[model samples]
Target: MRRLPWALSLLLFSAAPAFAAEGLDGKTLGLAWAIPFLGMLLSIAVMPLVAGRFWHHNRGKVAAFWALLALIPIALGHGIGTASQAVVHTAFLEYIPFILLLLALFTVAGGIVIRGNLKGAPGLNTILLAIGAGLASIIGTTGAAMIMIRPVMRANDDRKRNVHVIVFFIFLVANAGGALTPLGDPPLFLGFLRGVDFFWPTVHLFWPAALIIGALLAGFYALDSHIYAKDGHKWLDPTPPREISISGGINFLLIPAIIGVILLSATVEWGEVTIHGTHVAVASLCRDAAFVAIVALSLFFTPATSRSENSFSWEPISEVAELFAGIFITIIPVLAMLQAGTEGAFAPLVALVQGPGGAPDNLAYFWITGGLSSFLDNAPTYLVFFELAGGDPQRLMTEGATTLAAISAGAVFMGANTYIGNAPNFMVYAIARDGGVKMPGFFGYMLWSSVILLPLFAVVSIVFFAG
Candidate 1:
């Protein structure tokens, strides 16, 4: 309650008398980013102590607590009438369920795929992860992550030293590789909604993606080589390997269908429509129906035995659902305030980079944001930095090739900085835990990445991007 006065005073004193653009406050996009981000930081700092004391025994409960705290700022409406209304509505209605549905789809897909590949050969496992990462360009990050994570984790089973390899795999393949297409990451897709040419990022991000991929492949090979050399005695079995063909390779078809639905929804203008005489957005109705169809098809068509064999209980996904419930809640308010501050002028930093004298500084900001994303949720963090690169009174003036390149690089590569930075990070960690790898918690995961991954990225920064 006392905090309310301080917050109001800050807003009143700090609020501009007004802006030339009316809705727009006419501030630097980067400054606007600080609003929600500050809230995120405050939540992050407080969450650990709060959760440790009250929710000590339960990570799910702790996540819930923090997420609710994050929602407070958004709930207050950020002092903006219209934008705040939209945010409050989106947070409670759109965002939460969107996450849940996505999580559900991912869990189902991963469960189905990984169950069959539980005993996949080592080389095959490497190929699967690599292919999955490559496919992220086509599907979104979560799609590829869901399909490939279990197989990668299972393939690495019984190998203790090579666990971090999975972490890097999630960083590069599942997350960063998706930078090429709007379909790859949510922020880029949001860019697409705002008028970015869909194919542009793919062409431009190719070089940066290659650089990061090359670095990761080398790292994986080196790490795997060391592990293989040390563990050669246990490498092969005298008995011939059992064939593991997918029983429901047909079930996989549902995935593409799901993708098509999303694409169709994006393309069609289903303004407001009545469903059973109820008012709702046409786009939303399409989404819900599509997901329901996909889930129903998978459940009915899939063999009952296959589910049991794969341990396809709802438990693992339940955990992911629980974790994100909190994450989304906490970040909503911060995003609202940040959005209010920026007033939708957030993506012009790319133009600034190519502007008279901003490329070098803009590039530096990209690296810092990416580095931070490795620890923080890269979604909002990406937006923050993406907006910064956008420049003052930010606008998407340029094609965003260079800026998109930087955004892709940071959002994807730097996600390796921490386990929770990207959805794939948690997915991989969950798979490992289910498979018994005993992955580290928040900071512990960062420590490992900081010591190992960050230095390698530094080399990447110096050699490929900065140079």
Candidate 2:
């Protein structure tokens, strides 16, 4: 992967249709960007079948290998095309780092304990659900999903028919829960980079997050009660209390790591960087390298056994590694395409709020764009819509607070809409399935969301964003 930097210059001057169109420079650019992205989508759709048939014996290794393959087209297509350098840099430096942060945190937290021996299924559900939500911002929605999923699944393992339980769990824990912090989800992380204050999401959206969780728990209780009643006879022996062990809760170190990275980025110069013609910060590169090294070292050297006597195995970590490797590889190209398209053809979307009905139109734009994010990649979806919101001079005339509020809120909240809306949803689903819980298919999962999540989000829309 280090060789990727070598191709940067070569990718810059490559000739392709994306750069050849006369009156459609933007369209050409969009297509070039799309090359890698489309590759990713295809990989996701087809890789499962291919891996299942050809590499079922070692899906993780196959997935990891293909993830690397997915990166090739993205690097070749976007790295050398007539694509915008700004978008490319943003994709790699800003975006990739955020993803990596969540990944590292998820891996670390997954090492922690979630006592599966607890009785009172509802109580277990509430605590795990709360933990998932609280951790979402720090770990990224996906990270929290990876950490909590096995335990959540374990808690409800016998209730196989109640798949909605898992689906709704994704809605709250993996998606909406993260809306309150940049660490929570990619969209908010983008906001953090674009001048939004750190801690802003927590201050603004905590209540809304609480409301969503409250509603979700209520729904879970009602559903769980019915399921428990049906499965009551089957609830034979509640697992005995055994200490499940974990390490790396060194919370104090996280603060310094974060500060050190920021300081380092501020001090060095990066590629294509220009600071009074001197250079941009190279600290980002160093920070990223150090961050990765620290995480790898911690995971490697940390004792696999907890002090309580329970031992750790690589099974869960291996599963996350395989699946996320696939995801990271495949999505790079997709993000490249989205970033390319966001500027030209996608520009007119900004005009949606300009004509006639004004603020109400903006509100509609908010929901529509945000709702789409629930199904699409919320990060880019966030950037596109954030641009749309910011592009409006009238919106600028309005309070900055209101404008930022709408953009950040929509991007963060609506991510809960689907299984793939945020990264963690898939991790949670994947981990649960690994524990023998049957996860819903693409559209089937949507059906579950519609029944449980939609109504609750609708309430949020009314209470918070219905201006």
Candidate 3:
């Protein structure tokens, strides 16, 4: 298992020398090329459900199989050069920065343990969720989740009906809460990189975000109150009352450092270097390097006891890194098709978002972007729709503001619809399972989202996106 990443890395590096001059043309690629990508998605969705034990032990092998399925065919058909460039480009430009940020946030947030007993009453739980939602826009969903998850878990440690609590937490804190700022979510950050103003989402998405978040909060409160009343409102305090204190105070400083690194990558113009035909941005490279340092800093400075109290482990992040590596690789063709616009295989999909009169259908854009985002990675999904809506940030921000708003809202809000909808959703699920929260399996969880979120989204569509 440990050798799997190294082995895949070696395959990519060895193939790079063959493809130093050319790249695959998405314009000519057929729909069949996306088979491996679909295979990978199915494996993720079905493997754990049908063969939980087998998947648990060999998930890395499964991911590698699908990745190789794509790589081998791509290399054979397009020459090793194109395949290698794709691999290198995805690895250096996309996957590295992505996993590094997750690593840094997970490490730093895990290091800061809030120590005290707090009752998981309906009011307290709602307040904590609200705080986490607010903090998400400032520190990021991953950061807020890591910082808030354990404390929320501890607060409800003795409760019988707490799965819904964590589910709503994922809906609000890990996904929806990140709607306001670029710092809040990766999709918005990508939009920022593409020239969407930093506060554009704040101005445009505020009402939509407020509507969904407020509805979810009120719904959660109602459900929690019912559960509390049914359980006789039992007061269970294992530890004696004491004021809450935080350890690993230094990690609080690292949060801003993470934000700074991200901002630097966005604001700075550091030029680019061509690596085997792939253009690697210097600012991005520097950001990833700083993330490595941040991870080390948190690990070195944080007390071991702090992470232990938080129940932190590398398994969750490792799982994400491995799984998403395959996803990023396979998704290349799918993204390419989407990027190809009206000439590509996804032209029908592009057509769906347009009205009969040839105008952009705001409601269709909202649901289509969101529906795909629920299963696909939302960041890239956001990029796809952004391009589909005409990739001019200036136009999207002004005259096409409604279209942009719909894409933004869909990507951020509906990400909570599935565990794979966003990166943090699975991490939160893993952490909750580690804490013995008995979280639902993939489809089971979606059932919850369908019941709670789908109706609210319907309202959002009608109220905000309707013609």
Candidate 4:
């Protein structure tokens, strides 16, 4: 209430704000403001690989440090009131809701466990990958991976040459499969929150997703067949295989319940209320509240055996929450700069994506965004290119549909280029390694993506995005 003075000053400084929703002014800002955001992303990408133990222990603290680097300056320069607006606006609108959805998905997936083993024949392996890919859009990539990966590993545990199965799983289940719906991946959900329709990705991305996933499944089946033949077509069952048992069966229902709430939020309008000068929709409030409820309900009703069997812990979601808080805070200035378009510091980048006659080049949008998503967290990368292309959901969904499609596909699919690209990619890798699947090393994994995914992306670019 007392922050009106700084608020006015900051408002004045928003010389050329591109987004009506954005609070920060990018025209008056410079590249210096990007340091914290860049630092935060680099920490996420590099620290764990280089300083594994230190990162494990202090990742939360590191995130806080970068967030403070941005917040402290804002508070001092714009006044506590203005800085408070920045935090409140981004938190309520993007970060909190994003975390809540992920938390709900994480909790539900952890509760459901896949039991029993089957022969890891080429046909069965291909079918499992196909199922996981289909399920990715419903249960989320992380959830599907959590439920499906164990069965896959168990099925192929006896195979002498089975790394291809896990690698293909990482490509399809962990990344590309998630391209079809907002529930499938973090980036799409961010799009939804930013006013993209709940089914926008489903409609726009379905074909591209089908193309990549089908291609991956076909490639996987062929590779697995050759390998299976080498192993003498062994249908050799591993140990005493029991019929698949379902634990935490309640979570299956809860997942649809989670989706229902989000859908309701999108479908129904309940009005808006202002908090600290920012207006928030009632449906959004209800949706977030439902997520909290779902989390609690999932924890209470699901069998304890389900969690213990899955080795479930709060750590994964905890890390996600911590890292994203820093990202949402630090990215404010970056978005502002990108939003500024040719008038801002990122003119060169804007130019790079520009094609003949000043139109956005779909191919550039695909590769550049995907290239960055290969190393950076794909969610934030999506938001960056999203804002870069223009922050209007209406425009992006209509006249800019092809460009938006390119951005969405690139963010979701090329995340397989590196383990760090998406939350589930590295996770599946670590789990596979722990289960003794002989997963490839980081660069070696990139080599796989290079030989397999790069060519496929080229075909995608030619087929859908060439402009």
Best by lDDT: 4
lDDT of 3 at 401: 98
What's the TM-score of every candidate structure? 0.70, 0.72, 0.89, 0.94
**Over the full model, what C-alpha lDDT does candidate 1 score relative to the true structure?**
0.55
Ten-residue region with minimum lDDT total, candidate 4: 1-10
lDDT of 3 at 132: 92
Candidate 1 regions exceeding 4 Å error are 1-84, 88-101, 114-125, 138-143, 153-161, 186-200, 235-241, 270-281, 313-360, 389-397, 433-448, 459-467
Report the C-alpha lDDT of model 1 over 1-467, residue by residue, as the tens digit: 22223222222222232212122233323333344345554444345445645532464545544544443433343433423333334433344335434543553464354433243334554566578778777756776776666556656664545566566667666676788776676556545544455666777667767776767666666666666667643544222334555455545686667667666766778688532222456775667677766677777777777667555555444544454444444444334334443253443433433435444444665676686676566665665555454422124335444555566567767776766566666667766777666677777777777776677667766655563
Better of 1 and 2 by lDDT: 2
Which scores higher on TM-score, 1 or 3? 3
Ranking of all candidate structures by their lDDT, best first: 4, 3, 2, 1
Please give, for residues 312-344, the per-residue lDDT of candidate 4 as tens digits: 877777677778877888897798899999899
User: For residues 1-467, what per-residue lDDT tens digits would candidate 2 score against the true structure?
Assistant: 23223223222222232432111133344434444334443444455444645543465545445544544444455443323333244435554455456545654554555554444366567677777877777666765676566666656655536476677678777777787766677777666655465666788778877898788877777777777667752645345555664344553255347545644564456655542222234555566676677567556655555312223334434443344434444444444333343365443454564446433354655577678677665665666555555534234334545555656666777776666566566656766676666788778887877777667767776777655
Candidate 4 backbone collisions, by pair: none
Q: Report the lDDT tens digits of candidate 3 across residue range 1-467.
A: 35436534733553436544366666777888778788877777667668979987887778778788877877788777777878887777666776677677778878877788788999999999999999888778987898898888888887877898999999999999999998788888778767788789999999999999999899999999999888743546445666888787778899889888877777889899987676788998899899889989999998888888777777767776777777777777777777777788877887899888668999999998899889877876787788888778999999999999999999999989999888789889988998889999888999999999999999999999998
Write down the RMSD of all candidates, one decimal each.
Answer: 7.9, 6.5, 2.9, 5.3
Top candidate on TM-score is: 4
> For model 1, what is the error of residue 381's alpha carbon versus the real structure, in angstroms, after optimal superposition?
1.3
Off by over 4 Å in 4: 1-23, 233-239
Candidate 3 weakest ten by summed lDDT = 7-16
Model 4: residue 292 alpha-carbon error in angstroms? 0.9
